[model samples]
Target: MTNVLQVIPARQGRAVRLQAGQAIRIVNTHGTQVVDTWCFNAADMGEFMSMEHLHATLGSIFPVRGEPLFTNRRRPILILEEDTSPGRHDTVIAACDVHRYALLGCRDYHDNCTDNLHAALRQIGLRSDECPSPLNLWMNIPVAPDGRITWGEPLSKPGDAVVLRAVMDCVVAMSACPQDMIPINGADCRPVEAHYEVLT
Candidate 1:
């Protein structure tokens, strides 16, 4: 099957629909960018992908290839098909929002994952405040021996990617993380292009 590729600009958002049996590949084009991702059942938004359910089902904080991603309704939505980078994706961190920037001492408006998610969802005529926490791809948040979580730089190199097959028809939303205040995307907060491919 031919693949359809979409490039998500730095600090921007995108929305796409995937049918069951189709796969989406997210590429870390520049290596240091983090992609905040979320998925919803195409038939019902209430049964969206749940990070809590995934944690409970997998018993792990990070994603592993070949594992199924469960929704809030306990149904499989997508399966991790492949991972080319070090498997350090995070599922525990909440998407960045306007309030986070405020807490970080930034009184000005900043591009954030929450707003991006809303904008992406809006493209499909779905509007709600029930934005689910996302699976943070290529993001490095290491847990210390003392249970301390520290934000670190991503481990993926340029062109690294992860592929996931949709178990059910779903709408996927993604945001190139725009956090410049931390080392999550290396020294600077500059965003980079993220390449996405949908393969039938």
Candidate 2:
């Protein structure tokens, strides 16, 4: 049987898990940090983390109470189970990658979200390329009337967290925002930790 556990980032590490139907939650140990995320299925790869379908079903791009969290097939994967305000999260922002590095004028650093993503991969004993895109669950990006997404003011406070219950066993990867060049990370990315327990 699969069991739940608490994982820590320790400022430079990541918390990753291969939860098969077991629920898991990541807390923003510190407020205002973007949690770089990635996911994969222990079951399938083609039907992997699809954010487009998730946004379509969860209209205007935000999760709400009693709403079904989306899967690659646009079906419910995890329910919002608990949150301070479903409105406090953002599901549109894509995890930053090397290409983004060039776009963001960080060509000198050469590091990107993929670093954290790769870390997540290593934790689960997989390669970075084997991972799928992730949803910025509580990163708080807002859509302007012109269909533009702006980094909105953060809505999560210290100790505030998003809780999700897995409708199916799945693998997820997380980072404590190692970004340091974006508004989402205040250009000073640091670390965050997560704790999980099965909700029986």
Q: Give the top-scoring candidate (TM-score).
A: 1
Highest-scoring model, lDDT: 1
Residue-level lDDT of model 2, residues 1-200, one tens digit each, is: 33455554532435344454565566665566656555555566444555677778766466676666676787666666677634466566666666777787764755455677676567767664544556665577777789887765456766566666666655666666545555665434443454443444
Question: How many pairs in model 1 have backbone atoms within 3 A of each other, for residues 3 or more apart or on separate chains, i.e. clashes?
Answer: 1
What TM-score number comes out for model 1?
0.97
Which sections of candidate 2 miss by over 4 Å? 1-15, 18-21, 128-131, 186-200
The sequence of per-residue lDDT tens digits that candidate 1 reaches over residues 1-200 is 74767898889889888999998999999999999999999888888889999999999988799999999998999999999999899898999999999999998999999999989889878765687989999999999989899998998999999998999999989999888898898767678879898988
Q: Indicate the TM-score of model 2.
A: 0.79
| Candidate 2 Cα lDDT to native | 0.59
